[model samples]
Target chain A: MSKVYTGASMSLDGYIAGPGESGFDHLFEWYFNGDVEVPTASDMTFKLSRASADYLTGYISQTGSLVVGRRLFDLVKGWGGRHPLDRTVVVLTHSVPEGWAPADENFVFVTEGIEAAVAKAAEIAGDQVVGVNGGTIARQCLDAGLLDEVWVDLVPVLLGSGTPFFEQLGTAPVLLDGPVSIVPGDRVTHLRYEVRK
Target chain B: MSKVYTGASMSLDGYIAGPGESGFDHLFEWYFNGDVEVPTASDMTFKLSRASADYLTGYISQTGSLVVGRRLFDLVKGWGGRHPLDRTVVVLTHSVPEGWAPADENFVFVTEGIEAAVAKAAEIAGDQVVGVNGGTIARQCLDAGLLDEVWVDLVPVLLGSGTPFFEQLGTAPVLLDGPVSIVPGDRVTHLRYEVRK
Candidate 1:
């Protein structure tokens, strides 16, 4: 009953990132025209976080528990120690930081696989969809056939190469249920799709 | 007062196409879900064409002139002579195609400088926007500051690298009128941005 949603931006030719992730700055520089309409809630430091929040709220009103990868966790941590998620956030990783747990009340560092993490999140999420927020975790869910929906915000910039969010997928085709388009501003495009086996 | 509405997809770190364009397939693949509730009009091919039409029509709807790069012209020609734009299509190139004329007063070929072709397109489009369909010509317009607007439907796949759609561009920034997100099915996410400045 719980739907897993995967989302990210890609290139015109279908690449997630270029070699060593070069040219990202160039691409960002091209599309990095900051939104002129200022947000009423947050500053630019967590602009992406703010955007992601808008995305998460759309499907699952509130994620009882959220999960992320270690790298992504660290990135979020680096954002001036801002834990944007209001609910429990389980960082799925092997290594746990010394003082990371002290950062928040709902933050949990889990070494278990995505399934275990999702199971835990679902217990807390109840009837709501379990929000999977990391690239690796989302792909793992997709591979495991656990995701019920995918929301990709495909930004219109291409990085010649880098760490691809989604790579070689399973042979079996995944079907669509419904697709909708939303415009946050003239800069960001939101594409939501329901997944089917 | 031509507004350049630019559109393209980038990675999390922000790269348009990876070094060699290896990841473009994923981006294209995301758009296709065999099953979905979307109207047939929202098909991938139709949406791509419509976005181009919308951006072009926003400017020169009255004129039926199109300016594309030779590569695009060749690419389209290979598709069983299915020319999407049946107007005066000026293929901007040094090498002119032999016996290539206006396809029933709708498609015309031009092998020359971009300025002449676009100027002619402006004449033909009259109050309509000259629909620039190819990446090279689009980039040329961007570099020359001639493009009024660009409508980019950023897909959710990243090509680590490829022949960049905007390789000629430096670190120039464009204004985002904002973007709309269209998620069709589970894989494809379409984002359209209105070009400003």
Candidate 2:
């Protein structure tokens, strides 16, 4: 069955990005910390530990589509028009941006809301997993009771203050079950938790 | 050599305690989720999973002393004159409290600062680990570059906001080494990380 899940590489203090939108070096260190190479859909390839590479192999193979917030769509310039995962991306925004030529089929813009965005992504995912990027969209899915799982690549660095991976959740103190999975990688501990409905 | 370490049962969002001093019920749910009984110095006994029991068995046996803040000292009423771990406690405060009769050997009040409190704890700890409770004291130790390790019993819950386990650290980004150990409990992930000097 296709499931709705959000994932991020977070610092020890729960931050995905450090203060002033910084700390990517520490957060993304694991992607380049090892010897094994895992090529992505785009031009980039991740060098990861044997454990992390295997973990990502399963994760990448299982994920078919992704849902993201407008902020992220603008940040990476639409991941250079295609996400690294090489799957369809549903972006939730108030309105579609002005310029986009040839209409890339992989980029989907849903102005409706979080539910609509997730539904669109799920439709594209089918039997595979719908990967949701961390931040506002993830929190929205959680608030709407649409999120099924949370994957935290728990990094060891501590960014004292920054943008949290999970925060301002309307339904707070949300109880999750089982780190259904725990993989200790080079500088990251991959932890997965199922959100209890 | 005695190691200086700090620990806490934290929510997924990095809070040691929830807003308004709440959310402890969720944070501590792991302590009683299983059948194994782990008794403490105080009347309270932790009902834990076999994994958590063994994790604590090793932790308890290795800890000889503790360092805490004045706020915690007053909050637990000095833990009824004895801490749960049954170890000597060094309280960091600006001044001694109103009255503490007969001078309980287990409770030592340090009116100096964070360094003094840790030094006193180290002196008392001798060959075992000096356990520092989470919150201000733990942050202070990190700021002073005295903390050697961090142990987080990562609970599977999210408190929107609360007192952070580590915050206000003078050093913005403190890079840590290995998780060293990762022990998965019933509802908690017993994680240990070495603080890179």
Candidate 3:
């Protein structure tokens, strides 16, 4: 059975994206600029410690598929049909975009809902892990009790206002099992929590 | 010299207090309920591990004074004149409360502003640590560049909508130092960060 998890780089103030900012420049600078020690599959160089590199590479290698929201898909312009993760990508949206033809056959579009998209991703993932991207998509999975884990790379900068990762989740409170891991990176702290049933 | 620090128990969603709730009932349950292991002074019983108890008690013992917002002060009714930390409490507000009389002589009401309240608290704190309580007070201190550290006990429950600790901080971004420490409690994860100068 594949577990569904969410991974995002968020500000200490709980924002995934800041106002008037594009390309998640500040949020992802640590990864691309070699500020933190993380393992990368590409030829890009990183300045991470050997231990951190190993841990990050290990985590990334386990992802078998990804489920993304329409907002994130549009922001990245569908990743030009291929993603660095080298896994199947499922986009959850209301309607398919016009002339949405990808050079790669791994892109999937699910219009039913988040649950259906997650189900499709999990099916494609098989025994591996299904990674959920974007805050809204993760929140939807969380509300439906479909998420197994939430990994947050808490950045040091505070973006006063922008896209908040957690919105009005209604009346009932959602509980997490444990902060199983808290790893410190260059300017970010990586926190992992298990979403309890 | 005394350093100013802000501390609060917040939801993973970054809320300090929930709607229609008072006295931080949900946030401080672990401390009052003895859910985790913690050391107690004066023979007070705690259900926390010795290490956890020591860490918590040690942190509590370091506070010489506290700066709180008017809203939080009203919610706790000024803690009935006595606070659990046994430190001087300064309430920041526009005007003094009517018929304000605390049984303890440690309570002081500062009507000028957050800066004045903090200055007064720092004077009283002297060579000890001045603890800032409540979201508004902390935010004021953060914006004014008066805070030294921020300790957050990240509770697992998500409140969706409530009193958010971090709000629109204007154009400039406030950066924090490393999460210096991340300690996992029974139902909470304690994180400590130094406010960058």
Tell me, by lDDT, which candidate is best. 2
lDDT of 3 by residue, B5-113 (tens): 8878887777777776642655776565555644333244556644456557868778788888888778777666666567888888878888875323677888888
Tell me the tens digit of each residue's lDDT in model 1 across B147-196: 75554444433332344555545333334343433433234334444444
TM-score of each: 0.61, 0.97, 0.89
Q: For each candidate, give the TM-score of chain B.
A: 0.64, 0.96, 0.85
Error of 2 at B162 (Å): 0.5
Candidate 3 Cα misplacement greater than 4 A, ranges: A33-52, A101-104, B22-26, B33-47, B101-104
Query: Candidates 1 and 2: which is better by TM-score?
Result: 2
Relative to the true structure, candidate 1 has a C-alpha RMSD (angstroms) of 7.6
Clashing pairs in 2: none
For every prediction, compared with the true complex, DockQ reads 0.10, 0.85, 0.59
| lDDT, candidate 1, at A186 | 24
Per residue, candidate 2 scores C-alpha lDDT tens digits across B1-197 of 47899989998889999989999998888889899999998999999999999998898899989988889899899888789888989988877888874236888888878888888888899998999989888889999989999999999998988898897878878999879999998889999999988
lDDT digits (tens) for residues A68-173 of candidate 3: 9888789878766666666788989888877774323678888999888988888888888999974778888888888899888788777777776755564346
Among all candidates shown, the one with the greatest DockQ = 2
Query: Model 3 chain B, poorest ten-residue lDDT window?
Result: B37-46
Worst 10-residue stretch by lDDT in candidate 3 chain A? A35-44
Of models 1 and 3, which has the larger DockQ? 3
